[model samples]
Target chain A: MHKFANPTFFMKIANGIFPWATGISILCFAVGLPLALIISPPDYQQGDTVRIMYVHVPAAWMGLMVYGVMAASSAVFLIWRHTIAHLVARASAPIGAVFTALCLVTGMLWGEPMWGTWWVWDARLTSMLILFFLYLGYIALGDSFEDQERGDKAAALLALVGSVNLPIVHFSVEWWNTLHQPAIFGLKGFSVNAAMLQPLLLMVAAFQFYYIAVLVIRLRAELLSAKIRTARFNLAAAE
Target chain B: MTRKRRRLYFVGLGLLGLFSATALMLTAVEDNIVFFFSPTELKARTVAPEQRMRVGGLVEEGSVNKSGGTVRFTVTDTVESLTIQYNGILPDLFREGQGIVAEGRMGRDGVFLANDVLAKHDETYMPPEVADALKKSGNWHPEGATAQAAEAKPATTSN
Candidate 1:
């Protein structure tokens, strides 16, 4: 684990897997889209509109899952002083933000036709919205400081603080009466029909692979920018 | 681990724990959380009178009566039922035995005077799933399931 903490070493591993991640992501989407929209049964209540669940549910799950990754990486960075962990956390913020936003926007589109409202401040919805803002906050704070390490530490701390929202988002339906439905897949076990479950799970895998592919690109960019900074500093010292 | 690394762990855990405590407390005490209350919760002391809120449960079978633009219905958690009156067009998804949420203030007469009434599930799912679990205790009448049940079977009706 310590050996893998070097960014260059990690990049080599990431690059090796990058092609596979993209290939699998595309394959999942290819199968998932049809499975979700065509093969799945029209719901007794929602009819064709139920197809939106394929996108909405996976996006919501990824948004939370990505944030969990970010927080854990931040903890690793803070405790072990692994700069690679900070880079990983930094790379994850925008992806998490986009996923959270997708979840919210898709939620609105699904909500309007179904729940008769575009938005509600119910605990689940509000907590999810906060998660979106937390991502934005992390991104902004990551770049706010003049020193990169200072920015990294600041963002890492925010990620840790924001993690409290994870459990709240998961349990808000049960702990408080929320307009949002309690999750179908939970510790009690999945009650959803297998047909719907298959497509949803596939879409979730697609989203996760998508995140990995994008994260590698982002991490590489960060590493290059750091390299450029070091080169310019070396040139100045010689002059 | 180095002493500095050990100290970092302690600080991180402490901050995480503090934030969780604050969030949990805030969620527990906030009065504006107008998410649904079971009919029994409405009948009891948890909710203050006339404080605007949303009540949710299955629309009792045979209890929905629409007259002109106003629709009157009973929302039952099976343990108890609350009568609700809404003076506007209900959403297309509103049906007997379907889970419905209505937002409005209660009256001195105990009726939930709803300004807005809507279905709780998207077209494909049912909210009364949670309510149905409560209804199995005996007071829940299966009669009046005249409205199609909200369960998510494949679309069986030809449009």
Candidate 2:
């Protein structure tokens, strides 16, 4: 793991993985969407609108999952001072942010039909909304500082602090008398029937792969950007 | 702190000011953020005095009574039911046994006078709060659900 922290070695690995990840992401979505939209039976109750779950639920899952990854990477970067770890965390933020935004938008679109309102401040929704804002804040804080290392450290710390919300976001429906739904897959097991579960799982797996692909691509970009900055700084110093 | 630090301070202050303003705005619109009401809560606490607030729950089967432009219905969380009155274009997804949230206040005579009605958009999804209430009521059923059911499915319907 430490050896992989070296930028040159990390780049080589990312180069190899990026294409496969992208391919898998494309394949998963290609397969997942239709099955989710068409193949799955129109729910006995909800009918056709059940299709949005293929997109909305996966996005929400990724949003939370990516944040978890970021927080973990931040811990690694802070503890080990591994630049690659920081790079990985940095690369994941925007992708996670996009997923979070997608979840909110699709959720609202779904909500308007189901809930009869476009938005809600219910704990789950509110926390997710806050998660989106936190992403923006992390990015802004990362760019705000003049010292790049300072920026990374600040953003990493922010990510760590933000992790505190994940559990709350997850359990807010349970802990508080909330307007959001409780966990479908808890220790007690699933409340949903298998007909719906199969497609959902496939989409979730596809989303996870897509997340990894995007993270790899973004990591490469961050590496290249860092190299360019370093080269420019060296040239200026020489002058 | 030097002059550069002072400038940074100002920048931080500006950002903080902007953030604070946004928080205030969200706080002000807080009332508008919630979508539905459980029948139990609406009937007992929020609707008894006929408070003007949104009522959300499942549209009770056999309870929808269409009267010209105005539709009267009952929303239930299985434990309790709230009667809702709405005079508006209902969403295409609105259905029986589905999750719903309606906006407006409680009216006199123990009726929910809704200005807006919302339908659940995803299959198997309940508002987190509603789901909890259901679980508390011991009405929740968890069985034979596959992987997607791991997360709450939005209670969505079609147009």
Candidate 3:
């Protein structure tokens, strides 16, 4: 774990995993898309509109999952002063934001037809919206300062603070009388039937792999920019 | 303590404090955080008739009355039930014995005059054939199934 703090070592491992991630992600999507959209049975109640769950649920899971990654990495960066960890958090913000936005949009699309309203100020929905804003805030704050260290620390602190929303988002349906349904999969057992669960699980796997593939590319870019900045600073000192 | 150790403690304590604060705040605003109230909850408290609120419950079986543009239904949580009157298009999922949430003010009369009606779905998802079988077998429950009922059907499985 300490050795992984080295950016070069980290990048080497990331690069090795990148190809596998990309290949698996592509394969999952290739199979999962057809399974989710066409082959999977339409819901007994929702009909074709139930197809939206394939994308919406996975994206929602990714949104929360990515934020958990970001927050954990931020903690690692702060505690261990690992540049790679900080970079991982930085690389994840945009991707997490995109996933959150996708979740929100797909939710609205699903909601409009099924719930009779495009938006509601329910606890689950509101907490998720706040998660999206937290991602955006992390990005904006990280780039706000002239001193990169100060910006990183500030943004990392924000990530930690914002993490309080995660549990609230997950349990909001049960904790409150929200319009959102309770979780289909939880500690008790799966409420969803096997047929729907297959496609849902496949899509979730596809999204997870896709995130890894994208994160590897973004992490490389972050590493390169950090290197260029250091090089420029060294040149200025020499001059 | 080492500098790194100190930083670790700082972060750990910060998160602990933040979580505690959040829990307290949420507890303080518990009533406001609930999106809607069940029929039993609504009945348990005194609510102003003019104050707009959202009430959610299952639509009672055989209680739906549709007349032209106006629709009337009883929303029940098995413990208590409230009459809801709405004038608008209902969602595709709206049906008798299905859960629904209506937003509006309580009228001078006993009826709740709702401006918006949203259908709420349970977490259960199965194909039409399985649902038909369950219905035929007298094992169908709208909210969720009993463990015994679920175990009886080989076709029914969950992750």
Task: Put down candidate 3 lDDT per residue, B41-88, tens digits, no spaces.
Answer: 998889897999999999999999999999999999999999999999
Model 3 TM-score is 0.97
Which one wins by TM-score: 1 or 2?
A: 1
lDDT of each: 0.80, 0.72, 0.90
Q: Is model 3 an incorrect, acceptable, medium or high docking prediction?
A: medium
Give the Å shift of residue A150 in candidate 1: 1.3
Q: Measured with DockQ on alpha carbons, how good is candidate 3?
A: 0.67
Q: Encode model 2's per-residue lDDT on A1-239: one tens digit a residue.
A: 57887888988887898788788878877877777877766654455666777788788888998999898888767766788999888899999999999999997877666555678777789889988988898889999999888989999889877876677577666654445566666775554545566677778888888888878778878888988999999999999
Measured against the true structure, the TM-scores of the candidates, in listed sequence, are 0.88, 0.74, 0.97
For residues A1-239, what per-residue lDDT tens digits would candidate 3 score against the true structure? 59999888989999999999999989988998898888888878888888899999999999999999999999998998998999999999999999999999999999999998999999999999999999999999999999999999999989989999999999999888899988878765666667787889889999999999999999989988988999999999999
lDDT of 2 at A125: 91
Q: Give candidate 2's TM-score.
A: 0.74
Q: Candidate 2 or 3, higher lDDT?
A: 3
The full ranking of all candidates by DockQ, starting with the best, is 3, 1, 2
lDDT comparison, 1 vs 2, better candidate: 1
lDDT of 1 by residue, B1-159 (tens): 587677686976787688768777876786556577789877775556768888889899899998998889898988999999999877766899878889998887888899998677622232233324325533333322312232322232111
Best of the candidates, TM-score:
3
Candidate 3's C-alpha runs over 4 A off are B146-152, B156-159
